[model samples]
Target: MQSFFKTNWIHSLWLILLFAGSLVGETVTPKDRLIVETLIRLNRFDVSGNEKWKGAVQRYARSQRGEEGYFELVEQFSVEAELPELLRLVEEDPTSALSAKSVQLIFRLGEQKKLSRLLSGSPKKKANAIITLIGFVKTPEAQKLLDEHKALSAPATSVAKGAPALISTADDIKALAARTGNVKQGKVVFQKFCFACHKAGDLGLDFGPGLSEIGSKLPKSELLLAIVKPNAGISFDYEGWTVETKQGSFLAGIVSESDEELTVRMVGGVSQKVKKADIAKRTKMKASLMPEGLHLAMSEMELVDLVEFLSSLRTR
Candidate 1:
């Protein structure tokens, strides 16, 4: 139960329930009353298409100390004032499916240069933007942007077939799973690639989600699938973002932005901040923070062993 909570809290936040009832005769606390009223307003906006409701929602979100993922609400209602909320969502939840979808939406809206602005912002932003371009194939001018950032290219999880573990075909999955895995060797493999982003029994950083109880939740076959195609089942906890400033600089990682500034929590427990006034714009990408081709860094048997080690971690 505890393991599931760590993995599925984002899903909980995503599933906002609407108490579609009148509060005129009910008793409630101040916070609960505000939440209930806000939810009721959101429900009304859904049916009535009230333009004023859009502005009201935006103001209310601001009053709540800059709510995260409010971009979902903006897109739902076509809230013109909160169009910039799209970028905020990206910065706030870059690796999330919603952010990825948002990037495609940006392209459809003909904002190609916005990516360039993002690329010029920060190191991780450029890396994430590049990875996103690699993941989202249909974006216009994607190749051109990719060419410029060729120096910091991540393993192309979407199209590249160079790595042995970057698999999608059933044949690939079966072949890898059939390999004999030595638990000791698997621990070595885990320390090398998986530890940078994820931790297992105090061995790594917690930048990505915890994997201590992963085996308890998912089977070996599913674990292999997660490695070969990480974005296929990415958790929202690892959402990414890039914040660009007017001075032609940016920062990327997990972001916490209020009205005044953005605080980015990078891997290895690193963190940075930038003022909102200095920010020219922000960009989001649709790629896992864990790059593809970690398997490429090791042999095929090593990957099998890594999977074995991960499988050994039950909810202890």
Candidate 2:
């Protein structure tokens, strides 16, 4: 009898501990692919929803609260009605992308009247927000604010300083790739630059599309084009998307697919789906999700090596 009672007591204690952990979010795992995928699919970019969507949002928000997904939820949910919440978060965490996205939504929602008030906040906070603003708003007022704060921002770490500049043009780079390609050295270069967003063989994450079989697919010229000017041919499923909703929220991602439902996949590999009726406006973006000027960071030989490495990715 005592053994059975002790077993029940241990089981009850274990359950209580798990319940407590769930309440504080200690049970939340960042690498939980199912939860992450669910968060992505349910996000319609519009938080103003019916009971069903609202419950999903609230449930996930509670589970993922205080995680990065929480900030993402706050950012996705930012609308005209939520400006006060956005502003408070921006003021508290100006250096965060969450705050930057909030600021972008404010401008897109035609709430420029509030900009001056944000500018009047603490000089450092205002400056941080302005750094994100100048890129979106090109007006003289915005430019002037940027000029004042630009010097305060830290410069990006240089990938390549003053070095021997042999060639940068696409034709020349391709020719270089044909001549002196070193797969091993190229792998090193890729690990340094592209590995974070790309998966090559067993290396790196799947944030961007996997390149394990890229060489088998794309010809040499096409590969060169992808390297030099990524925007020249945005992949069909990977095309960029900028979404705005009637609630005043803004979202940017790659629109993966939309039939009865729409799916937007973010750069971090999180995908969200929304009903077709919920999206206020969706635009195909003009730019590649990959940033330009990556070649500028590499030595001429480094570029050749990287291309050669990618080109070697043929059949198994």
Candidate 3:
């Protein structure tokens, strides 16, 4: 068995060389093929061997592959094993495709524990990471984290401001609710922030639940709580699924079929048609695709505006 294993390993290397040679005469470059194979191998190891293979992948990524090449490299290396390193690389050279790839990877990983750690580390990366995670991992833990860290008021307030910085008083909620924020102002704020992950009237990111009927399903207080502290009472229907194949490829999407063929709608709106026979393991993420504390970027007024808009949504 040992001899056979050695023979197969040698054969695999020979095959890789032969394939590389075949590509030499074609438009595909050696670097491109190397990167592709590295991706294939990385997918096979369960997030463990990533460190061994990441250097080669990063080197190839640095080459001037242009937009398409950068995108491909990002997609390939966005796995869990490569995510931390990718995040560091993005910090050093924010323009590198690796930075965006880090965001994309966080979205796909859909792990709130990991995301929360990242958010607690860097405010800027945390903000962007939270936004991306919001579209993927919406859970009570996420919501709770956001609620705890939420900046309810401006950094500072003055006597001329006519109100305390943080409104913890019961009378404040009543006053704020009675104030009736401008719907037009709310629309602008929604378009700028919430619209990217939520849809009300045929607009916003398709990844999140539609808010067209939120008012009918949930009350104003509930809506406010969801925005302020999102992770509470998270509905499981919103959690996404991740599948790992025996061949080392990871796929995530909403599970469309479960019998013999496990169909999943992958990120970027692609469908992963996989056979159950090919699946090695499957994990249902506990977190919601929506990140916690999405409203951190918004001001108190903006949160009020968003709440007003959401409270207006109804099926009828």
Between the candidate structures 2 and 3, which one is better when assessed by TM-score?
Answer: 2
Predicted structure 2, TM vs. truth: 0.55
- Model 2: colliding residue pairs: 40-271, 40-272, 41-273
Cα lDDT listed for each candidate: 0.59, 0.60, 0.56
Off by over 4 Å in 1: 1-166, 178-180
For residue 48, give model 1's deviation from the true position in Å. Answer: 56
The regions of model 2 sitting more than 4 angstroms off are: 1-13, 16-151, 154-159, 162-171, 219-222, 257-260
| For model 1, the run of ten residues with the poorest summed lDDT | 18-27
TM-score of each: 0.48, 0.55, 0.47
What lDDT does candidate 3 reach at residue 236? 55
For model 1, how does the per-residue alpha-carbon lDDT over 1-316 read when each residue is reduced to its tens digit? 9989976986655433222212331222244436436765665434236544444555544443344444334433334444455455556645443355445444433454665565556466434533553344322355556665554445422332334644769888877777769889998778655654677886765667889888798877788888877777668756777666797644556777798888766554334467788889777757766666556546777778888888888987
The parts of candidate 3 lying over 4 Å away from their true place are: 1-179, 266-270
